[model samples]
Target: MHTLSNAPLRTVVWSTGGVGSIAIDAIARRPDLELAGVWVHSPEKVGRDAGELAGGEPLGVTATDDADALIALQPDCVVYAASGPDRDGGAVPDYLRLLAAGINVVSTSSTSLVYPPAYYSPDWRDQLQEAATSGLASFYASGIFPGFGSDQLALLLTTQSKKIDVITVTEIALNDHYPVADVMMDGMGFGRPLDFEPMLKTPGFIEMAWKAPIHLIADGLGVEVTEVRGTLDRRVTHRDIEVAFGTIPAGTCGAVRTRAAGVVNGREAVVVEHIIRMARDVGPDWPTSEFDATYRVDVSGDPDIHCAMNLGAAEGHGAGRAAMAATAMRVVNAVPYVVAAPAGLLSSLDMPNTLPRYAFE
Candidate 1:
């Protein structure tokens, strides 16, 4: 572990998108961390105040497009939130660049990095390991669904049981108020035909995105995963529905339920399931959430255990935005742990409990 300095860790936010915006706000709020720089991809966002981009009071730091300029500053850590459809392919190079430069990384992107050992690509992991080794930096990735709510929470619960059978983590979310058009329409195929294949529903995508949590839980329970498999079920709306993204025409796909499981001894011992709907009423038979989003973990074993976590915000704030804030904060909060860890890819199992530090003020 690296020694802690009395001064705040110099931190840079690597993007100004939804999650990145929240990350900026979070980093600004932390006294133990200093907001050193901000990066923006859009031409319009460049030169804007970081606080303005984050929808907060003006902070002196301005957003820049020059990655080299930010790296030259040599901040202690970077909150990486720049992500698109190609999650791993797009984020890996950025992570490599940052880690190789001795900048520890805590990211909401490339969520599969939540457990580097379980990731499908050995070559990519090797590259990351080599980079971190040379630079003496660490890389850690996590977020709401596949991060804390699933693997971490499930493993926490398992400590109580004498014997275990199956561990399942489920997320039920209503996405009507989420205003990301590209994600809803292009990436998820929310308003597309039932037969239309969305990038999210493509073969191996779910397994790639969520297998980390499944395998992580299995590893925690002293089990081996023989295979990782994904199954997707989508529901079409009977009536045209209005959403923040756009209108979902009647007969268009509006809801999706994906289950990614880790097969242990030819049976699913660990599973991560997502039930997302454009509207609450879209999937009547599916698991429901009182709030806009709910994360549930069920351990079917000697002593059955079930826990549900409901997520929401104040009256005026949209649940979607609140959820994004949670996702962003998850990584932001880990900055210190990532910066202090031994140089390499680290997982939840490799670190101590990461409590919310200095948040009361």
Candidate 2:
């Protein structure tokens, strides 16, 4: 671990679209981390000021698509919120370049990058491990639901019990779109047979994207995943509405479900399920249909424990903007730690305890 110092860390963000905007806002508000520049994927945004694009106060830095420009800035750390899970292949090469140039990276790419062999490219893993040998400075990738909620929460729950038998984590997103149907035949397993654009509204895709989350938790908790299975469902409604692309039938729902069992010494000990519903054919009300994302964590041991959290964009903090800020903050916080660890692929679980990485102040 690197020694703590009085000087604030120098950093830059590597994104310019969708969720990237949220991270940029968080960087502007944080005092301990400095936003050195911005990188946008859209060619049209290349010359615009970062603030105008992100809707924040102008810091004089303009958005650019050029990686060399970001490298020339001599940043101490790099916050990687650019490419999402599906686009990981496009982003890994850049990350490798950053590591070779001695810059640290943190990403929210494919879930399997947080684990090994279960879903990731073993060759890529080997490459990153080799890069780690270059120095302690490393790379990290996280899964939103599985990485933070399922895996981290499971770890936190274990602190409460000496004897543990089963751990389960479930996440349900009511209105958000997941593309399960489009990818199921690709071996993601049980999802809809919908095409790409429509698949985003499908259910099982979320579980496919998050498979590693449960796997990571089981591994971190000293257990083995013996079996992985899943299911997906859609809702039917009586109302219809016009969408930007077209019209969705009034009674329709796209859902996905997964049941994975991990066994230790021939006993099922861990189970994880991810459910997402974009349009419910039946609902409590129009408002509940428009709003409401529920999450729960249940751990069975000597004393059963559970955590049920209700989140509504009603307060303006959610998977939308708040998630952006949280994601940005996560990347910013990871910068310092990544800079000091050996490179390649790394996750929060792989972190050393003494690393002084974040300051709420």
Candidate 3:
């Protein structure tokens, strides 16, 4: 394990998108963390100040498109927030590169990596483990759903139960405010035809994206998951609705509900369900929440436990920005623990409770 000193840990922001921008702001404002560098994928973002791109202020830290330069800086950690659904090809190499360069990584890019061994093949898992060992660095993957909503938060709530039967974690969110076009449209099938089969609906897709959370919960509770299953359904909009990404025409696909079920002993033991909508009225009959973005965990056992968490727009931020900020903070707050952890793939279960720093001030 790497020992961290009392001084601030040097850090780098790996992208400038929604979540990445929020990470930059959080790192710059925290007293225990120093923003060392900013990496951008676009040519237009190159040479721009990181502070300007993050919070409209100048921090004198310029953004660069050079990945090698940032790796050479040898920062204590990297907060990777790049967006790409197809993890097998897009973000895996990037993570391997950083870990091989001896930089500890905490990321929200790949959801399956939240509990890598759950869904990844032996070859891939061994490769990442080997990289971490070779470079003497730690790697952790997390986010709102796979990170906290399902695995961490849900498992925490289960501690009060006297007997365990089934655990369900749900994400009910209106995605209209979310501005990621590729994710909202191509990845999720929102704003597309009802008949169109999005990548999310493909066979084994939901199981792969959510298998980590299911496995994490099962492992934490001392149970084994026998099999994993998935189901997906969509709803159409009744009228045109304007969203942050674009307009969704009437009769188009506006909502999607997906479920990844972990069966144990011939019964559904742990389930992760996503209720995503582009309009509020699209899925009225489905599980609805008062908050724009909410997560609910229901435990069926001797001592039944139910908990719901609501996340919405702050005083000056939009709903989308609020969600991004929360997601970024989930990983950003884990930096210290990750930096101090042993050189290997770390999960929320492996680290202590990661709370916010300087949040009250």
Off by over 4 Å in 2: 1-5, 116-119, 175-208, 241-247, 279-292, 312-319, 342-344, 352-361
Ranking by lDDT: 3, 1, 2
- Give me the displacement of residue 206 in model 1, in angstroms: 2.2
Each candidate's TM vs. the true structure? 0.96, 0.79, 0.96
TM-score order, best first, reads 3, 1, 2
Can you write out model 1's per-residue Cα lDDT over 143-164, one digit (the tens) per residue? 8887889878888888889877
Number of backbone clashes in candidate 3 = 0
CA deviation > 4 Å runs, candidate 1 = 313-318
Which residue pairs does candidate 1 place in steric collision? none
Give the TM-score comparing model 3 with the true structure, all chains together: 0.96
Error of 1 at 291 (Å): 0.8
Better of 1 and 2 by lDDT: 1
Separately for all candidates shown, the number of backbone clashes (residues 3 or more apart, or on different chains) is 0, 20, 0
- What is the lDDT of every predicted structure here? 0.86, 0.59, 0.87
**Of the pair 1 and 2, which is ahead by TM-score?**
1
Model 1 RMSD, rounded to 1 decimal: 1.7
What would the per-residue lDDT of candidate 2 be over residues 11-52, giving only the tens digit for each residue? 777876545666676666667667788888878888888777
Off by over 4 Å in 3: 313-318
Prediction 1 TM-score vs. true: 0.96
